[model samples]
Target: MHSYSRLHHQSGHAAILFSLFIPVLFGIFTLGTDGARAIQDKARLLEAVEVASLAVAGQGSDNVDLAKQYLEYYFPAATIQDSDIQIKKINCEDNDRCQDNESRFFEYQVTAKISQPTWFPGNEAIIGFGDAYDVASRSVTRKYHSETVDVILVADFSASMYNRWNGGSKRKFLDLKDIIVVIADELDSFNGYMADKSLKNKLGIVGFDYYTSRYNNNTRYFYSHLICGSNEKECTKTNPGGSTNSVNYSATVRDIFNLNSIAHTPWQKREVTNISSFEDVLLTDDMASLKTKINSNSFNITSGSGSGTAFYAGLIRGAQMIYQQGENPRQLIIVLSDGEESNKNTTQKLIQAGLCKTIFDKLNSQQQSNGDNVKARIFAVGFDYNVNNNPQLADCVGAENVFQAQNRDDIKNKILELITEEIGHLAQ
Candidate 1:
């Protein structure tokens, strides 16, 4: 009987041990799952703060109210209470202190804290069971501001331009016109807005054909006989215009830098050309003359001997124009081309000159040493050009800025998208 009692006692003791361990195991599993979930939520909250703060930093005063709107759009769960989130230029003064010297860098400082009840009964001990525990996160992001942009559009107005053989030939011409109008409209849209209130970003247009020329009140060769006024409506009108005895010029072949010598396309090679000569290609009242010439077939591609694609020249001139606009502004060149450079110079050289390594290096050196902040982004488009053969050209613009369109239908949409993106960046 005693032996039986001993066995029973041992069994009871084992049962008690097992019972105690069951709860401990349960607690471990519960803690593991809930802890992981809490960690995930914490990470998400931190991300929300980061995204919201970055959005605020990039925005203008008019857009500050909309910053939170973007944050909610990005993170619906993280509710922003009044003054709970703040963004400002990174400076010593942000912590309520100011420096005698100027602040060099700007960052988006985000502060957020969250509180929620514990899920498990025992978790109160780990997460302040009796009261809610606060989970807070802080993050800072640098500001990307486009102080100024020197913009130039190198358009193709070659003889092949008149080729009616292609589908939507007339539409192609209109597309170019629309592109010009769109760019002008975009610039005008940004007209009094600037990152620095004191800075005024300048805008210029350079049209290219066999040649390249800056568009002024006298630019011609495509549509409307009158050089387009600063306003979009004036640009669209077909009349002789504001009628102040103004002279208009058409963009033509010689204005562009021709790579081929007489043996190939007939333009002198290695000859240093002046901007004034590039300027002279514009004919007073050139648009009217261009329309007449286009109708008459006088401006035909076969009419010209030069086949040298002066793309590099256009890029160089465009960069020059940007540089001339004061080193303080950003420099951007939009190069539009349809076909590969036929008998012209090597395409690689042109792509690299202003779009690739050289420009970036130049800007980086200036920015580091002098805070010139003169970086420029190129938007290279190969319209109807064979993608495989010409891939390198657009690639030189950097993956982000390069663009391609299978045909004319995609041109306007793509251009508009790029312009819109840039505007957003500028506003930020």
Candidate 2:
């Protein structure tokens, strides 16, 4: 009878122990489930913050709303209070101090709250833990800007550029000119970093054909216009014909001594001079005047009998202008052409002369450097030209940088897209 009573007492103790331990086990399981959910919410919040920061950084100061939208999409179960979100411009020049008002980067901070109910009864009260958890994340994004910029516009003025497309009303030259004008307008309106008065962007123009001008059978010239002046009026120079007067005087005393009354000798002069090699016509910050010069100079008909495209000559001339700029400036060359090289022999001669190969080699070398900054970039546009079959012209720049257009509207749209992309480039 005593043994039975002892067994009953031990059974009661075992029941009590099981009752006490069951609640502890349930509490541990509920805590683990809630903790996992909280950790997942925090990780998701971090991802959203990073993505939002990158989007805002890529788009500049105008994309704050976009960041909020991204957060809402990524953390649909959590409440993202606007009051808990902070957006601030930060200067990460050295050690991410962020004290300076001049912002070079943007900082995004997000605080998310997620509600998770306890699975075990009285677990939250016993643990003194809240039903909801808060997670905060921060991210910093930087902007990209070059210290200086030098742009060279190389335009092809071959005879074919003046020809109209198959069914288009506008000539290929007009399309090319319109694209150039758009570029000029964008440059003039730019107000970003390195676009200030102390670091104004420089632009140069080159127009290339087989023969720019020929006064006689022995004379052949390459015409270029450099606009480096502050305004249009200062960019003009005396024409070639006005520079000298070649008058043959007879071996008579009357002709040699008659200086006062020379029968009003007329000076055959032009307002511009075309040199044997492409010369700088203007190298200036005056984008307005540069656009005017491009319109006036690039739209002319082929001037000489040998109607061929000197693509290398034009590219070399533009490179020459870019090379003259300050060291490590962001250099870009935009080449527009309607056809490939028409004179292979002349092209080979130029390449041997170091004019064709030198420019491309320099560009390639700059692009291949190990530094973060790309010292040079080349963009080429082909008007009604087969870029796939004839890749040599685009290869001078880079195959990926080439663009082909069929008509005027297509050219304009493509150029606009290029400009927008260039302007919106993210800084490293």
**Which candidate wins on lDDT?**
2
Instruction: Name the lDDT of candidate 1.
Output: 0.46
**Which portions of model 2 show Cα errors greater than 4 Å?**
1-147, 166-169, 191-196, 212-281, 302-306, 325-328, 348-357, 361-374, 407-428
What local distance difference test score does each model get?
0.46, 0.54
On a 0 to 1 TM-score scale, where does candidate 1 land against the true structure? Answer: 0.44
Question: For model 2, what is the C-alpha lDDT against the true structure?
Answer: 0.54
Off by over 4 Å in 1: 6-24, 48-146, 157-191, 195-198, 213-310, 323-327, 344-379, 383-387, 391-428
Cα lDDT of model 2 by residue, 1-428, tens digit = 99999999999999999888876776677668777777876787778777776665554343345667888797666665666667664434432533243433333333333343433334433452355666777765555343445667777766667677762576766666677777677555442334334656556767766423322343433332111112211122332111132211111111211223321122122333322222244456788887776667435654433345657546655665666542334667777787567645434433344443455556545532346444576777778878776666655555688887777656655554444334444432
Per-model TM-score on C-alpha atoms: 0.44, 0.49
Clashing residue pair totals per candidate (backbone < 3 A): 14, 17
Compare the candidates by TM-score and give the number of the best one. 2
Which tens-of-lDDT digit does each residue in 208-282 have in candidate 1?
A: 443443324543222211222232122212112223323122211122222221111212223312111222122
After best superposition, candidate 2 residue 98: deviation in angstroms? Answer: 17
Of candidate 2, the 10-residue stretch with the lowest lDDT total is 247-256
